[model samples]
Target: MMIHRLGTMLLLIGIGALPAQSQVAPLAPSDITNIPPDPALKNWSVRTVQIPMRDGVKLNTIVILPRGIKNAPIIFARTPYGAEKALTGAPSNDFRLALPTSYADLAAAGYIVVVQDVRGRYGSEGDYIINRPLVGPLNDTKVDHSTDAYDSIDWMVKNIAETNGKVGTIGVSYGGLTTLYSIVNPHPALRAAVPINPLVDGWMGDDWFHNGAYRQSFLDWVYRMSADKSSKYALQFDRQDVYESWLKAGSVSDMAKQLGVDTMPMFRKLVDHPAYDEFWQLQALDKRLGKEPLKVPTLHVHSLWDQEDIYGAPAAYAAMEPKDRGNDENYMIIGPWRHGQGMVADGSKLGAITFNGNSASWYRQKVLIPFFDRNLKGSADPGIAPVTAFETGANEWRRYDRWPMSCASGCPSRSKPIYLSSGGGLGWTSPTGAGGFSEYVSDPARPVTYRQRPILGTYNPLTTWGQWLVDDQRFAEARPDVVTFVSEVLTDEVRLAGQPIAKFFASTSGTDSDWVVKLIDVYPAEYAEAPEMGGYELAISMDILRGRYRESFSKPAPIPANQVLPYEIKLPNVSHRFLKGHRIMVQIQSSWFPLYDRNPQKFVPNIFTAQKSDYQKATQRIWTSARYPSRIELPVMP
Candidate 1:
């Protein structure tokens, strides 16, 4: 009976095993679809092709055309960033959905948009050089950004069947730099160009170094950009706080070594040229383009609070204004925004400050699109002003016949000096006392942070580096190393419309030092609207200058210790009003860490390679007496 029961169970198991054998036989390789069907675009068709350059290098170009549309003008953009990624994402019927926020208004207007990867980045062929210089002394190669842009545009007009043979270029930051390059020797088809927050200069104050201080925070970006051809690799930090990591790394050289970026060609170039040498001067766009006559109807867009390329647009505008004989070819727009904020973000607000309206949207719909239409499509004139600037405190847009109306070479603006007095007082009158000074001990070990602590990496998604320029300045108010001077509450609105110059009469105990000057707007202590802004210290224009470069930006010299000298620091441009009932404040400090590399008190041949021993505490003095009047020269608008 037991043997018969076992046989029945074995028979059932055999039946299950037969099914398993069939499964193991791999029945007909299941047909599973991996890719989804392409979306039927209603108004747009996309295609990518390799556009050959004059050098025979094929550049990856993405062309987006308005379906059923004919003879549309081409809006061309050349960028080191991926062209494919810029215009492609989840498939959609509405082409506007795939377009970047900056191009939304342009896309709705019906035009062929072309984006190409610059040489040696993403899918483009040829070597990638940082801010590739024009075909000149710095660039000995047969092809530079100028020639490549010309070649690409030449090919674009001839090959693109739907294009009207008229092209306009637009881009931000490095893209902006390339846009400016395209117009150097513009193609016949190139008509209009817009360069927003472009990198016009590096050694003077755009990207790499500001004045003589190295922007060490950009090293991470350098590493990521130069790491791979596709720019896919990101630099990973072991510590969560970039400030801590960078501080621990000591010198810029040490930081580069620790981050394994010391071997990068850009890094090596930075280390090799610590001064404003010919290498940097040769690549300065403002200097190069300024000398040439305006060939394209170019509109330069500047941001009042641009953190990355603050010195670019204004500098370039000043350089090119001489050539704009009719004040028609060269135009400028300065808005209240961070770097490239007007391009991709709603400019209504930056950090906690609100501008009350969508400044960016207004710029696009009202100014940008119309400008392009008139230039590319031969539409009616937009009648835009030569200069359109957004006034911050007033929260209003103001049009001017010319920018910096107060202080340009031919403008009517006059620079008036506001003196710093003893006992933390600041006023328009010069100091009367013969001898008075404010003293502080500047320590490299505990340098004043540029912003709130735990600063994130420059390129981190959640990083506050973009908005740090607009952050409240109260964080550095109570620090011992920082000296504060305040003016009485304003009875009337004080409007400044141009660059503010910091002329310091100071001395340092150490051979070398750094000076940071901030012009701040202090709100009333109590406020009904936006209570959080009460007593807020908003920096209007601020910058740092290494003492070594006080005499000349290109040269470095040790200070005559304990002897007061005149230090003239040129702060970035500003268009702001110190409203009635508010106060003006000026904070002076010796260091702005992580943002700028620390300046060792003891003079070293190169601050990048300064040793731990070179770093030292120094006694700094700001003399504000009649003999040594430390004052800020403001282009006060009447």
Candidate 2:
């Protein structure tokens, strides 16, 4: 969703994107498809204004109001992307409101809809800071996104006409981050907020780095939103095959030079700090949330398979839920969606897999509409559940008073462990003897492709890279470098409702390495209901751990060659059901490129600065002996 070379497609910008929290949001089907403008919009007036901040910088804002409506509650959205065209430009006047779409419904329901460009973005005055850090304990002169939101809301309520003296904020991706920031220092009139797929932590998850593993996708993203806010592809390459160009460009640092990144401040700053240093830590919104949760009621929505920003929503909800227990104000909804797919009407499918119903439409109508109506417009409570999520294999939606419904009180959910045997078998029994392990040679020059084909730019609408998380894992199933462990066909359903922990007894032939663990659900070969579902290898949850950072992210030390070590890789929490006759699988590999930048098997002070010679082929081992058993711990559901 980040502005790309195609010249800032307003609907596409931040539709499904993030940053170091700035990764680009992806476009939903509705974004590209055209619908005719609604005749009802003719009754509404469009006004553009330069709203001033405390520091005197002005933001470009657009207000759309129904002429006959008065005392309407204000529905506000702040975005880093341009607001003018998206708010007014359109074929289907209904599409004007952008993702959380249903503009016609909101307008007909009587509300003052407003959209504004965040300071430093298009038509706004000020320097832009990507994922601007939330300034804690700031003086009146100190400014941050939190202050910007506060200032804007303060001005709107005081000057804007025909208001019910109430305000609500909502956005997806970066705008979601802004929504999160808005409530960090909320305005008096701000009644409710919904932050969809917001980037909660840039260092551990979400946009740039994940547990010290730098995502190359960040580079592709930052390039699209350069200092001058132009297209990265236009500035760098005219060629379509981006993968070949990236490979030819060589190392991570070298790619910067090829992109002519001398003027791209964000890229420079990012490469300079490759670790989870203070720079990334400061931008993390979850850490900034602190012990005392925000007082404002919030509904945090996210997709289970969101290519970007997957870690933010649940993390933010968990952090706040404990403090706001029984308040019925903190809520979360996770679906089988890609980034920003929650806003699309047809959310039943992602690539080859399909859910039974239109999940997105149900959410918008049954949840979002009622949530705002009650909180912002003083209507009856919708009585929504605290957690509403979709179960993948089951193809159904479930609600809970709390997420991951604990089994302590005889709930259906349970936790089970599946061990890796000496052979390729996955079973409940642990290995008996000593010195049993599986080894594979990982060649840096021949790294496994993150996807089946060439890697594309992050914003390429033509590519399936955006939904690669849910892509068929069979692409890498036969690769020699990947070690596979398979479980027998299950007799009953096995539902995983929480985080799955990977306890790996691993070693490398060199000083440094990377461990990528994938928890997969393999369909039987004779699957009949859906032919494409037959032999499907779907990755339920997966994560990587940089061997050097196994000890500390700040001080990445090398591993002793051939000495086995225990590594704990906590995959993102998943909601899935492995049905009867299906087999569970675990794939262990050394590299997943260029989804994650290649890790030099040899120890280096910094991977970003490593020379070509630093990259080496190493034989990685996964031990399953009784002395050091490796297994996957699943939060099973009853």
Residue-level lDDT tens digits of model 2 in 531-590: 868989999888788888898776788899999899998898898999998999999998
List TM-score per model, in order: 0.94, 0.89
Q: What is the C-alpha lDDT of each candidate?
A: 0.88, 0.80
lDDT of 1 at 155: 89
Least lDDT summed over 10 consecutive residues: which range in candidate 1?
A: 405-414
Model 1 residue 220 distance off true place after TM-score fit, in angstroms: 0.4
Q: How many backbone clashes does candidate 1 have?
A: 1
Judge candidate 2 at residue 334 and give its lDDT.
79
RMSD (Å) of each candidate, 1 decimal: 3.4, 13.9
lDDT by residue (tens digit), candidate 1, 1-638: 99999999999989877855466555567688677656463667778999998889999999987677788888888888899876654456777776787654576787788889999999999899988888878778889888988998888889999888999999899999998888888888899999999999888888888889899988888987899987788888878788788778899999889879999999999999999888888888998888888889888999988899999998888888888899887889888999999987588899988998999989888888888899999999888988888889989887777878733334576789989987899999987778689999999999999999888888788887789999999999989999999999999888888899999799999999999999999999996788988999999999988889888777898998999999988999988989999999999999998799999988888998999989999999999998998999998886
